[model samples]
Target chain A: MTPHDLKQQAQQQLAQQASLDWLSLPQKAQATFAALDMPTRKTEAWKYTPLTALLNTPYFAHTAAGQVDESAAADRLGQLGDVSRLVFVNGHLHPGLSSYSDLENQGIVTLFSNANDAQRELINAELGTAFEPQQHVFATLNYSCIEDGVLIQAPTDFKVQQPIQLVYLSSGEAQPALAQSRVLVYGAAGSSLELIEQYDSLGETNVFHNQMTEISLQPNARLTHLRLQVEHESLSQVNGLHVKLAAGSHYEQHALAFGSALKRNDININFNGSNAYCRLNGVFLSKHKQHIDNHLNLEHGVPHCNSDTVYKGFITDSSRAVFNGRIHIHKHAQKTEAHLNNKNLLLSKQAELDTKPELEIYADDVKCSHGASIGKLDDKSLFYFQSRGIDRATAEAMLCLGFVNEMVEQFPNTAVIELARQRLAEFFNDVDQLNHLWTLE
Target chain B: MSKTPLLEVKDLVAEVDGKTILNGISLTVNPGEVHAIMGPNGSGKSTLANVLAGRDDYEVVSGSVRFKGQDLFELEPEERAREGVFLAFQYPVEIPGVSNMQFLKASVDAVRKHRGQEELDAPSFMKLAREHCKELKLKPEFLKRGVNEGFSGGEKKRNEILQMALLEPSLALLDETDSGLDIDALQVAAEGVNALRNPERSFIVVTHYQRLLNYIVPDYVHVLAGGKIVKSGGRELALELEEKGYSWIQ
Candidate 1:
C-alpha cells in the first residue's frame, strides 16, 4: 500500500476509538494530522530517517483494554530501587503493576484518564503548548490516538526527593500493533524534579511506538530528565521531546537508546526567558542491521541563555546512524553561549555514520561553536594498551567503553548507569573478538 | 647473577615507514646490571625502544631478539609483555575514561596469570598501589582519574615508573623517562627505579644526558652514534661524555 492509504487507514482506525470523541484536543489534533503530510525522504527535517519500513507494514491501533501479566511487568522492573513507578501496557495504565502511594499523597502524580476538575484544567492549559501540531506529524498523530497518559506536576517551591519512573511496555502478541503514548510534565516556579521514562517490549513482536513528551519549566525551576529505550530488536520507535525553559530555569536531559529495526529521536529545546540553562547529553548504540537517527535543535530565543550538547554513538555490523545538531541564536539574544559536539565510533567496516553540526548565530555578540567527528578508534591508543600486557581484543573493548562512558557517567542515578553499562557490554559481546572483555566492571 | 643474559639483541636492524633507523645494533644485558645507552638527536634512541616492544609501525628488516632463551619475534606484543618485557614509553598516550587503577590492575593480573601467580584482589591491589604512589611522591587520587588524561609531563613519567614497579618485569626498558622532568621529579623517578633493582632483574636505561646517572649510576655506559654503539665503557664514560659532549665521542 502507498503511504497515504496507510495514513487513511490509521486515521479511520483512530476515529473508531471512543475516547477521541470526548476531548476537544484530540479532535483538533486529528484535524492537524489530516492537514499534514507524512514525512518522506524528501522532507528536510527527516531526510536521514526514511519512513518506508514504518509505513509499508500493516499495523492496527493498539488499545489499552488488553490483558497484561502481573509477574511479567514486575520482572521488567529489575532493581531500579526506591522509585515510584507507573506501568503502561500497550497504551493504557495498569494500576495493578503501578506503585505511587507517596507521590499521590503529595499531589505530584495525576493520570489523564482519572484527572480531577482542577488537574484537568492544568493538563489542558499546558498539554500541547510546547510544539506546533502542523510542524510535527508524528506528534500530532500521537495526540490524536493517545488513549491515556501521565501528568506530573511539581508545586511551587516543592522538591521531590525520589525519582518518578514511567514504564511503557508493548505486549501485542496477536498481531502487528501501533501504540501512541503521551507525557506532560510541569515544574512550577522554584520547584525541582527528577523524571525517568523507560520503554520496553514483552516479546519478539513487530510493534511501532509513536511517543510525544512535552515539558515546561517555570522561573527558577529545575528538571533532570533521563530516558531509556531498549525494546526488542524487531520493534520500531519514534520519539519527540519538546521542552521550554523560563527565566533562571535549568533543564538537563540525558537519553540512552539501543536501536531496534528503526529508531529516530527528535529533541528540541527553546529558551523562552532570559538567563536559562539547558544541557542535552545522549548516547545511542546500533548493531545488527539496525538504524538510528538523532536530531537535536536548540533555539536561543532570549538573551543571556546558554546551552551545551554532546552526543556519542557506536555502530557495528551493517548498522547506520545519523546525527544532526543545530544551534540557532536570535537577533536580540546577545551574550548567548552555545556549544555542540557529536562524536561517533564505527566498529565494523560496513557500518556508517553521517553527522552534521551547525551554528547559526544572528546575534553578533554570541559565542557559538560546533564540532563533529566520525572515525574508528585511535591506532596509537590501541598500541599503547597492547604494550601494557592487554590483548588487542581487550584493548579495543576498553577504548570503545571509554568512548561511550563519558556520557554514561553523566546519568544522575547510579542504577541507570549500571543498566546502561550492562547493555553496552551485551552489545559488544556480539563481536567475537570482544566477547568477554566487558566483564571488568 | 646468572651467566646467561636476561636479554640479547644480535645485530638488530629496523626501519620505520620503509626508512631504516636501527642499522646492525647489538646489545646484551645481564641480570642485576644497569646499562645506560646515551645518544645524540636522530641517533635512533627511541626507534630501538619501540622496535624492542614489537610496534607494528617499525619493520624489523633483519635482526634477532631473544628474551630468556626464547625468540621474542615469534610472540605478539602482549605475549612479550607477559614474558616479562616492559617498555616505559617516552610519550604516554592519554586514555579519556579508563582509570589508571583499572589499567594497572589489568596489566598486573595478566602478568601474574602468565607466571602462575594468583591475581590480587581489589583491596590488596589498592594497598599496593597506595604504597607505590607514596614512594613515587604522587597523590593517591591520581589512581581514580583517567590514565594520563590531562597529566603533566612529570606526572606521566612517574606513572610509567609506577607501572614498572607493579609489573616487576625481568627486563625493564626505560625509554627517555627523564627527558621532561624537573630536578625534584628526576630524583623521585631515579629513587623509584633504584628501589626496584634486584639480582634477578636488569634495566636498559636510554637517555640523552648524564644528569640522571648522578642518582641511578649505571654499571655500563654505551654511546650510540649513527644507530651503532661506537663507545662502551664503565660508569666513568658517562662523566667524560658529559664534560666533552657527544661530538667528542664521535
Candidate 2:
C-alpha cells in the first residue's frame, strides 16, 4: 500500500472514534497533512531510508487495550529513584502504574483532558507552531491522528525538583496496531525541568508508534532532556522532538537510541531569543538489518546564541544508519557560535553509515564549524587486547561498547547512566560476536 | 626434572604484506635465562616478538614453535597468552574509556581463570596493583586512568613493566621496552622486570642499543642482521656491540 492510502485509512479510522474535546486538533491537522505528499525515492530527505517495512506492516488499525503486565514493564526498566514517572501502556496513560502523585499535587503534571482552562489555552496555541510544516511532512503527520496526551506546564518561576519521566510501553498484541503519543512541556520563566522519554516494547508484538514531544522554555528557564529507545526488532518508531528556547533559557539533550526494523528521529531546535544555549550529545547503535535515521536542524534566529552537537554511531552486522545535521544562522544572528560533529564506527563488512554535517551561515561574523568522520575499529588496539588474553570477540565488543561508553559517561544523572549501561550491556550481548564482555553496576 | 626448553623456535620464517621479515630464525630458551637480541634498523627485531605473541599481520611462512611441549602456532593469540606467553609492546596502545584498573582486572582474571585460580576481589586487586604502581614510580592515580592515556614516554614503558609483573608469564618477549625511557625510568623499568624474574620464567629482551642491558643484564646476546641471527655470544658481545656498533658484528 502507498503512503497516501495509509494516511486515508488512518484518517478514516480516526474519524470513527467517539467525539472528544480535542478532536478538532486532528481534524485541523488532517487538512494540513493533505497539502503534503509522501516522500518517494526522488525525495532527497527519504532517499537512503526506505519505508517499505513500515508500509508493509498491517498497522493502520488500532489495538484495543489488552492485558498489560505492569510489573514486568517495571522490571525491564529498573528504578531510577525518586522521580515523577508517567507510564503509558498501549497509547493510554496508566495512572495506577505511575508514581507522579507529588508532581500532580504540585499541579505541574496534568492530563490534557483534565487541564485547567489557561493550560488548555496554551496547548491549543502552541501545539503545532514548533516547526515549519512543509519541511517536515512525516513529523507533522502526528497531529492528524492524535490521541490522548499529557500536558506538563510549570507555573512562572516554579521549578521541578526531580526529573519527570514519560514511559511509552507498547504491549504489542497479536494484531498489528498503530500507537500515537504526544507531550507538550512549557517551562515558565525561571523554571527548570529534567525530562526523560523512554520507549520500549512491552511484549513481542507488531506495533508502529508515532510519538511527539514539544518543549517551549520561557526566559531564563532551563530544561535537560534525555531520550532512550532500546532495540526491538519487531517495532517501528518515528519521533519528533521540537524545542524552542527563549532568552537566557538553556536546553541540553542527551540520548542513547537504537535502531529496529525502522526508526527515525526528527529533532528541530529554534532559538527565539538571544543568550539561549543548547548542547546535544547522543549515540545510536544499529545492527542486524536495522535502520536508523537522525535528522537534526538548529536555527539561530537571534544574536549571541550558542549550540553544539556531538552524535556518535556504531553500526554493525549489515545494518544501515543515516545522519543529517544542519545549523542555520540567520543574517542578523551575529556572534552565534555553533559547532556540529558526527563520528561513526562501522564494525562489520556490510554495515553502512551515511552522514552529512552542514552549516549554512548568512551572517558575516559567526563562528561555525561542522565535520563528519566514519571509520573502523583500530587494528592495533584489537591486537593489544588479544595479546592480553582477551578473546577477539570480547575485545571487539569492548571496543564497540567503549566507543559508546565515552558518551554514556557524560550523561548528567547517575540513575539514567545506570539504566543506559544496563540496556547497553544487554544489547551488545545479543550480538553474535559480542559475548561475556559485560561489567555491569 | 624435565629438561625440555621453555620455548623452542626452529626455522621460523614470517612475513608481512608478502615481505619476509623473520628469515629462518632459530632460537631456544631455557628456564631462568635472559637472552638479549641486538640488531640495527630493519633487522626484524620486533617481528620476532610480534610473531611469538601471535599478531595477525605477520604471516609465518614456515615455522615450528613449541611451548611447554605444545605446538604454539596452533593456538590463538589470547590462547597463547593464557598458555603463558606475554609480550610487552614497545608502543602501548592507549584505550580510552576503559580505565587501567579495569583493563588489568579483565586481563588478570582471564589468565587466572585459565589457570584454575580464583579471581581476586576489587579491593585485593587494587592493593596488588597499587604496590606494582609504586615500584614502577607511578602514582596510585594512574590505576584509575585509561590504559596509557596521556602518559609520557617513560610512563608508558613503566606501565608495560607493571603489566608484565602482574601477568607473570613464563615466556616474556620484551620488544624495545626501553626505547624511549630516560636513564632513571630505564633503571626503574629494569628493576621492575628483575623483580618478576623467577627460576621458572624466561626472558627474550630485544633492543637496538645496549643501554638497557646495563641495568637488566642478559646472560646471552645475539646479533641479528637481515632477519637472521648471524652471531651469538655471551654478555660481553653486548658490550662489544655497544662500543663498536653493527659494523663490528659483520
Candidate 3:
C-alpha cells in the first residue's frame, strides 16, 4: 500500500477503538491530510524549501524503543538542572529517563495514551483545536498517526514554579525510520507554566522526527515556552507549534534551531479573545548544504491584543533558509498592536535566504509594522572588533554569535540560554572560520 | 646619547575614497612627551589618527610611520594594537552582543598573549577591571553591559580611557576625545589619561579645540591645516592656536 493509504488505514483503526475517544480527531485529521497533501515546490509556503530528502526517503515505521541510551539521556537531563524532565527515546517514553512522576500523579503531565478517563476527556477537547489544519499538512499528518504523546494541563489558578523540560531523542534502527510524537498543553484560567523542549539525536542517525506541540491558554493564563533544535544534522525533522490565547492571556515563545538535511517548523499563534499579548523570538542557523524553513502565522481575531515577533537566520556555505511571517488582523481586531521583524545573515556568496513578512490588516485603528533584512555581517562592526586587537576569524565568530545572541539573551530562562549557547557554539564550530569560539568565554 | 623617537612620521600622505585628507603630514613624538595636534574641520586630524592605527579604508598613497623602531604600516590593525598602539576613537562603535568586560578581556588577552605574557585568571581580571572602573568614576556594572551599548557620550570616552588603562599601550593616539565631553567628564577622562602617562609611553592628542590641553598638558603643539603641519612650537603654540584659530596659520 502507498504511504497515504497506510496513514488512512491507521487512522481508521484508531477511529474504531471504542476505548479511545480522542482517536476521532485523528480520523478527521486523516481526511484533512488526504485533501491537503504534503507541500511541493509549487506551494507558496514551500516554494523556496524543497523537501527532497523527506520526499525521497523510504521511511518505515519505528521499531519499539531502539537502543535506549539510559546513561546518555540521564546525563543530558542532569545537565539540564532541576526541572520536570520527560524523555522519550525512539517515540517511546523512557520512565527511567524521565523525572516527572509528581506532575504525572497530579494529572498536570501525562501520556495521552495512558491518561485516565477524565483526563482523556480533557485531552480530547483540547488535543487538536489550537491551529487550522488546512495550512499545516505536516501537523495533520503527525496527529493522524501519533504513536504516543504528552498532555500537560494546568488547572485554574495553578502556577508551576519550575519550567517543564521535554526531551525528544531519536535512535534510529539500521533502516530509515520515522518517529512521531506530540505534546498538548492546556493552561486554565489564571494558570501559568513554562516549557523548555529540546530535540536532539546522536551522530549520523538516520531518523525523521515528526513532532507537534499544541498549547491553549485560558483567560488570564500565562505561558512561557522555549524550544531548541540542535545537534542533529543527519536527521530530517518536521515540527509544528500552535498556540491559542484567550482573553487576558499571555504567551511568549523563544526558539533556537539549527538546520539539518530537511528541517521545517510551522508556528501559529491565534488570539481567540481580546487583551491577550504574544511575544516570539527565534534564531535559526544553516550551513553545509543544510536547509531550514520557518513558516509563522499570527492571527488576531479579537481586539486589543498585542504581539511582537523577531526571527533571525544565519546561512553560510551553500545552505538555504526560508522565513515567512504573516500577521492577519480580522475586521474587528481594532486597537491591535503588532510588530514583526526578520533579519538574516547570508554569509557565503552561494548561501541563500528567502524572507517575506506580510501584514494583512482590515482594522482601521490597528497599529502594525513589519520589516525584513538580509545581508552579510556589518563591516563596521567587524572593524570595531579588529581595532580592539581581535583577529578577523575571532571577530567574525563573535559577530555571528552576537547576532543570534541578542535574541537568546532575551530568553527568560537562564538554563535555556546556557543550553542554547552550548549548542550554538557546537553548531558554529562546524565551520572552519568560527572555530575556537568557546575560548572567547 | 640620543634615543630614537617613539614615533616618527615622514611626509605622511593618506586618502579615503579618492579624497586626500592628510597630505605630507610629518611629525615626531618622543617618549614621555605629549604632542597636541590642533586642526580645523577637514584638516585630516582624524585621518592621521586612523592611518596610524592602520585602518584599512584609509589608503596610504605615500608616507612612512615608524613605531618602536618598526614599520608601522606593515602590521595588521590588530597587530598594530598588539605592538603597543592604541587609537581612542572619536566615536566608539557600539558592539551590542559583546559585553564591555568580555571585549576588554579579549583585547587584553590578545595583547598580553602577543607579548608572551601569561593570561590572567577570571578573578584577577575582574579585580583589575573593577579597579580601573573605579579610577574612571564609572560604575563597575558598566563592565557587564554591551560595549558602549547605552553609554552616554562622556561615559563612552571614559570607557575608552578604561580600555587604555587595561591595554596599556605605549603609543596612544587620542582622536577628538574631548569633543563630546563637558568639563567634568573631560577632567575625569584627562585624569584617566594622565594616570597612564609614564616615561615609557607617548601620546599624540588630536583635537578641534584646545580646551583638552588645559587638563592633560602637552610638551609641544603642532598646527595641521590643508593636510600638513603648518606650524610647530612649545606648549605656547596650543595657546596661540586657541587665541588666533587655524586661519592665522593656514
Second chain TM-score, each model? 0.98, 0.98, 0.98
Given the true complex, what DockQ would model 2 score? 0.50
Residues A336-424, model 3: lDDT tens digits: 99999999988999998999999999999999999999988887777777777888888888888778887788888887888888887
Among all candidates shown, the one with the greatest DockQ:
1
Q: For every model shown, what is its TM-score relative to the native structure?
A: 0.94, 0.87, 0.94
Question: How large is the C-alpha RMSD of every model relative to the true structure?
Answer: 2.3, 3.7, 2.5
**For residues B1-250, could you state the per-residue lDDT of candidate 3 as single tens digits?**
5778999999999988999888998888888889998888988888899899878888999989899889998899899899989999999988776788888888899989999999998889999999999999999889988889989999999998998999999989999999889999999999999999999899999999989999989998888888998889988888888899778887
Q: Sort the predicted structures by lDDT, highest score first.
A: 2, 1, 3
Clashing pairs in 1: none
User: Fraction of true inter-chain Cα contacts (below 8 Å) kept per model?
Assistant: 0.63, 0.62, 0.50
Model 2: colliding residue pairs: none
The global Cα lDDT (0 to 1) of model 2 is 0.86
* DockQ of all candidate complexes: 0.68, 0.50, 0.64
How many pairs in model 3 have backbone atoms within 3 A of each other, for residues 3 or more apart or on separate chains, i.e. clashes?
0
The lDDT values for all models are 0.85, 0.86, 0.85
